[model samples]
Target: MKQQVRELFPTPLWVLDIPPSDAAPFNAKLRDEIEKIISPRPNVPSGSNWQTPHDLHTRPAFADFTKLVEISARSVAQFLNVERYPMMITGCWANINPPSAYHPTHNHPNNYLSGVYYVAVPEAGPDLIFQDPRPSLIMPWTGKLSPLTANASAEQAVPGRMIIFPSWLRHHVPSNEGTSERISISFNLMFRNFAETAASPRWKATAGQE
Candidate 1:
């Protein structure tokens, strides 16, 4: 008799790395804009700090950043083979985590996709961790296992790297041990129907036809 192993129920996560030359300028601009716009506060329940308004993508100072996000999002849609319909960013914000700061586990509500782009990551910075979505799998497990059976997985934070994952996935950032702050920009994206637009003729032609 012959047996084979099959994998099922795979989750998708996308990571994009921006070159240092491009990322450096953007990082400097972002830091300056963040400093001018708002001061850090205890917005999140955990130890981290969150920027207010959640519409940073719409600001003039973030035009280039927004373009980067749009391009990245389109790439993700293409990878998922959903490029027919349009997609738009619903919200965007920044997180500044200082030494010993951490973010509690949470999921983005009412959003289809969520992502984070690291602007600055110090040495020994905290890692982004995702928890297993299946609760039953961990109920009766006691032995050690590989990623397929693990309860959680961690990804190191790297400057200029962007990570995208399902909005429903629960994730958290561990406490930062580095001396400097770990800065990142996070955003949510959702699919938009072409029929909703009245200004585009192309949309009118395809609207209600899909």
Candidate 2:
């Protein structure tokens, strides 16, 4: 694969609140399922990598959750003026109270769009950190210089808040802090292989890209 780059790229960050009427029922359903799994979580070694497939939409109730995301995603695509539904949900799953250093900084792999919906965010630890997507650090090209905080920012996540961005963007969550656990569902979005249309490393300008 070859690398490509271009100017005038757009990145859009979206925050959504989960409708209580819809989210409540789902939460109840999920809690029930969690108990049924018959799995013990505390036994998981600290700082070890462990995931719960139960958080994925594998359950029947997940159809509602997926539908909710689809509806919201299409709306975002329209607002950004991207190809309507050009993206598809390839995989989704929920994570547990990850130990210290629970998540490492990384980018979504082999997907066009990616997002995270906060279900339960602890008061401390694991704040979403969004990094500068551009690789080069040279500044002043735009005739402006950024200070230290310019490299990244810790995103404040609230319930019903959903963040979406190009899949390649690099982001991560630090370890959880509060007594309560932190949980969020993540999703991947893919479009028709754009290789036939894309000619550069830059994302093709489309709706909702901004």
Note the Cα lDDT for every prediction shown.
0.84, 0.69
Sliding window of 10 residues with minimal summed lDDT for model 1: 197-206
71-188 per-residue lDDT for model 2 (tens digits): 7778777887866437668787776665453677888898877888776666675678888876767554445434332667677866566787778878877777666767677888
Q: After superposition, how far is residue 30 of candidate 2 from its true place, in Å?
A: 3.5
Q: What TM-score do all the candidates reach, one by one?
A: 0.83, 0.73
Worst 10 residues of 2 by lDDT: 140-149
Return the top candidate by lDDT. Answer: 1
In model 1, pairs of residues that clash are none
Candidate 1: TM-score? 0.83
Candidate 2 deviant stretches above 4 angstroms? 1-7, 19-28, 34-38, 99-101, 138-149, 192-210
